[model samples]
Target: MPTDDLGGRGERIAAAYLTHQGLRVLDRNWRCRDGEVDIVAREGSALVFCEVKTRRATGFGHPVEAVTPAKQRRLRVLAQRWLAAHDEHAPDLRFDVVGVLVRQSGPAEVTHLRGAFT
Candidate 1:
């Protein structure tokens, strides 16, 4: 599959997993002038911003490892932009990473890294 398609699939899987974990999904692929936030959800009083990274294998590195420091900073900025646009407030905020490994002959593996970054 194409990279974009793979990413979209990963986001769908991640959103489903998060919903099962009790977070209410508010948005997906939210974009601004700064960047895009893959998933936005409400976990009780906390606003959760998630970044989904999908890979066919771990040859280069684990998908979560792709979320570099710079990327984390960008996600934080994007989260603030998302909040401002909605005029929403949360008592707490969190950054999460959902790593998806899609195999050709087996079920995809998903790893949720809650509070992966500040």
Candidate 2:
């Protein structure tokens, strides 16, 4: 599958997993001039901004490793933009990274790294 398609699939899987864990999804692929957040969710009283990274294998590195510090910074900026645009507020906030490993013969494996960055 194409990389973009794989990424979309991973986002879907990540959203489902988060929902199963009791997080209410607020947005998917939320974008702004700064960047995009793969998924936005509400976990109890905290707001969550998630980045989804998918890979066929770990040849290069674990999918989560792809979320560099720069990327995390961008995500934080984007989150602020999202909030400002929507005029929403949360008492607490979190950044999460979801790594999806696709397999040719079986279901994809998903790893959710919550509070990945400040």
| Maximum-lDDT candidate | 1
In candidate 1, how many clashes are counted?
0
Report the lDDT tens digits of candidate 2 across residue range 1-118.
Answer: 9988988888888899999999999999988878788999999889999999999999999999999999999999999988888855789999999999988879989999999999
Per-residue accuracy of model 1 over 21-67 as CA lDDT, tens digit each: 99999999998889899999999999999999999999999999999
**Candidate 2 stretches greater than 4 Å from native:** none
Ten-residue stretch with the least lDDT total in model 2: 81-90
Evaluate model 2: give its lDDT: 0.92
Give candidate 2's error at residue 112 in angstroms: 0.7
